[model samples]
Target chain A: MIPALGLIVGIALGIFLDPSVPVWLQPYLPIAVIAALDAVFGGIRAVLDGIFNDKVFVISFLSNVVVAALIVFLGDQLGVGSQLSTGVVVVLGIRIFSNVASIRRHLFHA
Target chain B: MSSTTPPPPPTDPTRQESGWSRLLEAAKPRANRKTAVATALALALGFAVATQVQATGKQGLESLRTTDLVRILDDQTSRNERLDLETRRLQATRDELVNGSSKDEAAVKAATERLNQLRILAGTVKATGPGITMTITGQPGQVTYPTLLDLVQELRDAGAEAIQIGTARVVAQSYIAEHDGALYVDNTKLTLPYTIKAVGDGDTLQAAMNFPGGIVETIRQQGAEATVTKAPSVLVDALQQPPTDRYARPVPSASPSAP
Candidate 1:
């Protein structure tokens, strides 16, 4: 419950800070940085359950970095990079939401 | 050959949850999936409420000047800033459309017809295969109207068949004005270091302005502003107008004279 609540609260605050800020600055927000902290929490959960995989963690990290940079670059070229950066954050947002949802389900499953 | 999937990882407490169970026991009613989902949803709802409340509150406090109402005042000011930016962008688009479209179709058609007659009068539809260049610079402080007008007149007297100021075409009838301290050429705001180009005879145009107290001399006295030069290949485009209706009749004249 705490993790899920944290994820939602963080995203809400992120959106509220500059709901209309040029999309480019979206991924750079402290909120997104904090949201990425979820994978750490997930790693913790996995280690506790003896199911940690270094490969999965590494791949996820690499993909996030690549996608974020690519969005910014493409946006800069097309004159919509700021908006596209916001889109990259949205992708991160979905991941955070789903991870929280799954953790919730895992914890509460009778 | 059929391939068998690898078995799921072992859930041995010895390797995994050594201290997690103790932590879980200390924190009773640790949220299950459903409870966690509910909590997340609640948090989302709370944030939405707070955001809306702040927005409406800011709008309400715009007229108030209470010393303690700093937050309210700042929000209102930022909102206004965003609105002003949007207005400027829209205004630019509107000007682009207006300047692009046909202004006086009938007059343009008449002008074109008159040009054809003049071509017959001059015995040729073409002006010349060579021209001169007129480099117009702003005054030391800023580029203003009188200077711009003088430059335009000089180009005209120099027998310039084509003239372009900055990026805008110098049509037969174009209006240039300054609004809110920004200089606009043909209703389009120009950036600094304005350049005006003219296509005409180099020698004839040069000789025409060779007299003392000419445009170049006047501009030079004004300090670091406006220059005119001759070019080998100055291309002037004959401006075209949108087609007018062929069978349209003129409006009946209102006879206001003493009858």
Candidate 2:
């Protein structure tokens, strides 16, 4: 509940304040968002399973975002930024889908 | 068996109380702190996502490299220059058309004046104007072709618009040649005494001839009697054959569509 409240507050603040992103971070923002989404889905699934660990959730969230951005940065250095971004998105998307499916099953018992 | 089961009843309440305490212990402040940390990360993630989305929505400039940005600026500058040049060319053409329409009365007057001048130059219209006439009487061989040519050149230089030597009209393409010790102007044989009539400002024409060491002096040096007289009105009756152009043709304008 606190995390949900914090997310709502953060989004509201972002909308009202309208802070600009730096140029260097532009390439990483989309990947970070996707990674964050995957972590949120996994956290929800863990909660439904009665195995939610706040430390693990926070660690996974940070790591997912950092690793995704790092892969893209490396890909850029190797002149394959777009291909690696696609690869990262595909993997994270699959994880999000599976977690969401499990959450749904746990909530609906179907 | 019933007696043995009844003996354990005394410990059931204590055991149940211990289970409840353990459950309470698990739901303690430690769990709350973890939740707080997770919430803080979530907030940061949310803020980053929202702000990034807004920035992306604003424009794609941030995603481009400095080189790409500079290239785009250069492309736009060149395009602007090309557009400006096109605008200036179009403005000149538009001004020509607009002025043509707005000054229709003045343009018509100028056109009429130009047509009269062209007709006079062509010698296709009868011209009557104040001018000078010169009669040359000399020995047959004394009045050479060069001396007559020099006299015509002097009259033209003094603004003689229309000229006639004997019966031939002196248009721009009139030819004069010497054949068999005699002068011929446009196939007309001239007599020894030649009369030259020129339509222009009489005073200027006479002054041009009388200028010291001028055409009169040059002709007199050849032992020819050259006399000049200014007349209020001199008539030129010769007409020119219309010229034909074989190679040049007019280009058709873009026509308006029929409504």
> After aligning candidate 1 to the native by TM-score, how far in Å is the CA of B180 from where it should be?
4.0
Backbone atom clashes (below 3 Å) for every candidate: 8, 0
The sequence of per-residue lDDT tens digits that candidate 2 reaches over residues B56-120 is 78867668645567789999999999999999999999999999887886867888899999998
User: In candidate 1, residue B215 scores what lDDT?
Assistant: 64
lDDT of 1 at B119: 52
TM-score of each: 0.30, 0.50
What's the true lDDT of residue B246 in model 1?
A: 86
Give the best candidate by TM-score: 2
Residue B234 CA error for candidate 2 (Å)?
7.2
- Considering the two chains of model 1, state its CAPRI-style docking category: incorrect
Tens digits of per-residue lDDT for model 2, A36-104 = 888887776555444566777787888888999999889878877778889999998988887777656
Per-model C-alpha lDDT, please?
0.54, 0.80
Where does model 1 exceed 4 Å of error? A1-110, B1-129, B138-141, B208-210, B237-259
Q: What is candidate 2's CA lDDT for residue B199?
A: 96
